[model samples]
Target: MKRGYTAKELSGKTGMPSTVRGVKARAARENWPGQRRSHSKAIEYSLDALPTETQIAIITAQSQSRSDFSDNKQCFPAKGKSPPFAATTLNDDQRLTMGARLSFVLEIERMTAEMTQKKAIATIVALSKEHRLDLFLHDRLVVANDRSTPTSTLSERTLKRWISTYREHGEVGLAPGRRRKNLTMPLWSTDFLRCYQRPTKPSVEASYMEFCEKYTSDQPSIHQVRRFLDKLSPEARNIGRHTAQQLKALQPFRRRTTKDLMPCDVFTADGHKFDAEIINPRTGKPYRPEATTVIDVATRKVVGISIGESESSIAVIDALRNAVQHGMFALLYVDNGSGFVNDTVREIVERLGGTLTHALPYNSQARGLIERAHKTIWVNAAKKLTSYIGADMDRQAGAKAFRISRKQIRENGGTTLIPSFETFMAGIEYEIETYNNAPHRGLTKVRDPITGKRRHLSPNEAWARAISTGWQAIIAPSDVLNDVMRPQVIRPTRRGEISWAGNKYFLDNLRDFHGADVRISYDLRDASKVWVRNLSGELIGEAHLDGNASPYMPKSMVEQAYRKREHGQIRRTLEKLRMLSDKNNHMSIVEHSSAPILDAARLAEAKRVAKALIDSEPTPFTLPPDPIAKYQLWQKLNADICNSLPLTKDEALWHSSYQTNMEFAAMRRMFEHIES
Candidate 1:
């Protein structure tokens, strides 16, 4: 019935364009037709350009203006407020709308006492154009309903339905979102979802492509598949994307409640590799050491820590010892890691009168406290070093620092870039101290006396509180701890000594056990001595590394071996150089010079030696041989000259011998003169 109203009148009813300028702007934005009033500069605007919900609000205001809200008491007798429904089922806007609808039904019912329900509604609509209703109900009820819906508005049929819904089901029934109904997943959606629910977590479009691979007629389109997936619960949609163990993260999980726990009640342990590198004591190579840590669950204190080349059995045992020294725990909770599940760790737990419990495999979330502690403590500590090689570390920078450390170790036998063993241990200690003293969010808040503000308790504060409350730690006897923590291994007793860990440890008692298996427990820190026990657990006496092994320290032997090879190489190189120098000296002098070099002593000695050599080899002087032999030789030579038949063998031999004989010197000289 109302065709036009002033901007203020419209805003009062419609709950939009609340200010004068807002009305003008809304009119301009929507191209609303308007006319300037002759009485004032204000404008009167038609409802056609406004949203349907706004139009309905202005009409509803007219209905309320016709009669007092008290006028509705006869048809709906004044009663105490009905019980409040479970309003949580509806969102804020939905809840406001349900209230507005119920109010409208009550107002309509009052008007019904005088006339037909439809005519009563019509009469109120006519009066609202001339008059405004009470500001309170109009603003709270009418405007709230107007603002709730976006373009849609209430109608007589909708009002009638809400009246019935409210009477039967209370406020929750009026909110469409609160209504529950069956949502049957389309059968064909299974095929599309099958492709989508792959481990690769392919996109809807990619999944559609794969779904079309089978070429079935009932296949859903990509958009349809997306719509179906939108209806699927997150867990169902992601079932294939993550393993079952991982899926628990998406589901509800109980926080490991540490509220009731006391200090030393439960100790949770985990291992982390230091991000930065450290020098290995055995070899100078840079490496990341596993920092096995123990944390008191209740106080969140870092009670113990052990760093090693890996989270080995020894490392775990040592970490337990370190933790027990701080406070003996009733239970040791750790993951199913090899280092945690081994017999040595179990033995140590037994000695301390504690239970060893392991978390389920792949469920690290249960040990969230210690795992988080590793990040807060060890991770932060490692980043302080220059050689940090964490994943988030700057790639080029970390690599550069690592190269520097490695190069130093190779050429200088040590490096400052990587932390030294002592420095590393000290840093870990400082970090743990800082961690224990720092405030933790997991702990309950306590008032800070200094600042006069509530703050979370630091681990140290928490531990102290527990201690003061009469909670005490059970300390293991020193001798018992020492015996239990020692690592035991069965090694064959070789020769008259026990050989273990590359060191031959000798014991007088062990000689009788030679060629037999003996259980030996040795301190990792001190390899100098080992305790040998029989297989039956009887003491077999202590053995020392120096006994019958070698006179030198074992480490010194390694150093000596290294130096020995190095010095030998130097000696061989020097020998080669000397040989080369001797030959080179002579050849160089002779080849580079042509001048003759002589000494007077050299020539005189040469002459003296030559004279002695000539005297010693003097010419032979002897009497002549028999004249008959000489004559015979001459006759034979004369006959040989005349005939090739030659002289007889004896005469030929005699003549040859007589000619060569120095004893026939006279005849030889005569023959020589005659031949000449």
Candidate 2:
């Protein structure tokens, strides 16, 4: 940056005169290319014009000077104060001023080695103007000097003042008053703040309108208000503009660290509805299944997971119960879902000597880890399935797949693409296992044992690492776990059975407690059985749906309704066949099975044998299911007209005759009303 050096600075260089006047005399005698200094008689000689040996010495000295300037860390503090870098007992701004000036002193001292302070100051001003200082490149010097203007150059007057102050107070004298105090706060600062800092975050123009309305007499101009408001600290300016909850995203939050936590020190659980459709085990229909997952927050390892029809408190517990089988967590943090905030989860957490902490209501951000896990594990896997119905899937292709699946089911053809629940679950299990074994980004990084490349620890590896420490998890006893995991609800035992989730559970012993209000608790899965408890927490007995019922009987009203729908569908199909057979209803479908005419003698012998067999062995007979019952089934299934099974020929004639009688017509209308 330096074009040249003063006579005194150049004098001590190798092969140059030792005295300032000697160097000046030599410069004049050699006809050196030099320029006169501003406000001084001394001359600055050009380095290129100087002798080659002198030039090399000067350049080498300059290089060392600048290096030392950057490395200088000495702080000249006030009397009786110990020297410390930044932790000294000085005011914060005072330390920064000292630090900046100490660095400045180093550069100035090197320049003033054999020269006066004035000469050194002139050199610094020249170098800074040419953008020569390392600090000048990035505005470090300007920022230290507290300059906010567009210009990068420092003025001579400012340089003079800094030198004078340093002479008087040593290093501490460099701590000047900050320039921020120049801008003045308006008297209506409070009112302006109130108007501008609103939750709606109205623009300055809109807020100015409100301010004008509030203070009609002495309101400042919009520009004036904006200038003063710009001077306000960011924290103050943003206070009311963002609600506490809204500010959380922008605010700095303390992280809950996992380094001090063991494998099961904390756990979080959530349910995610899989994006893919799988065969609904019961109905054989395409449906999305919800996966309830429990994860060890410390290791980011999934300890338990269960995929079911829908998300429920039962699902939450079932996942947690699986988690406890490995190790009980010390704490539980989850969103404020009904499944998590219930007394059941609370009781279980307490039983494990831990605490259940629900996040703020409606705060989805609280489930961040689990939600991300769902994307990495479940969602990515769902995208691989043919039955996937995720939003991102191609619309035409997804619709085609959906239609194909349903068509196959409707036609009684086995599905070709949509996976059965069991197969889909097996795929899900593989995904989970892979997730656990694969490296997780949140885990601590380590050198790969085989490759020697850095990689994050896998969930399983992290878990094992935590186990290697002295920490150990408190395992829950099986009996205690079984007792606590069963979430209890009060239900009345009715007619030797208890109804739950639209399913009836019966046991012979339950009949004694009929019509009694009993506490019922059961596993989320296996709804076929429920444990009956008295109000006092006494275990009464376990009731099962299979009790006293036919092996194939519908155990629930849901199944009963399904059966009714099935029969109605069959009737409609039969009616369509009957129409195609014969409109007169003379040709019965059973007639196709009748034996053809045999030879006369053989037919007579067969008839005689059949008669004897029928006499000897009385056979069970069942009336044909109403094949003709569907004549009116389709028309009036949901119609406003009267609903009835098809009437036989003789019955139709009787019905017509009865309709003529006034009393019969009135009665018939009553029946029709009931049917409708």
lDDT by residue for model 2 over 477-501, one digit each (tens)?
Answer: 9888778777678999877788776
Kindly provide the TM-score of model 2 when superposed on the true structure, using C-alpha atoms: 0.50
Candidate 1 lDDT tens digits, 359-455: 9888888888888898898888877777788888998897788777768878978775775565566566667878999999999999999999999
Kindly report the root-mean-square deviation of model 2 from the true structure over all alpha carbons. Answer: 19.3
| Candidate 2 residue pairs that clash | none
Candidate 1 steric clashes: 1
Clashes in predicted model 2? 0
| Clash count, one per candidate | 1, 0
- After superposition, which runs of candidate 1 have C-alpha atoms over 4 Å from their true positions? 1-88, 109-119, 128-183, 489-676
lDDT of each: 0.72, 0.71
lDDT of 1: 0.72
In the predicted model 1, the residue pairs found to clash are 62-128
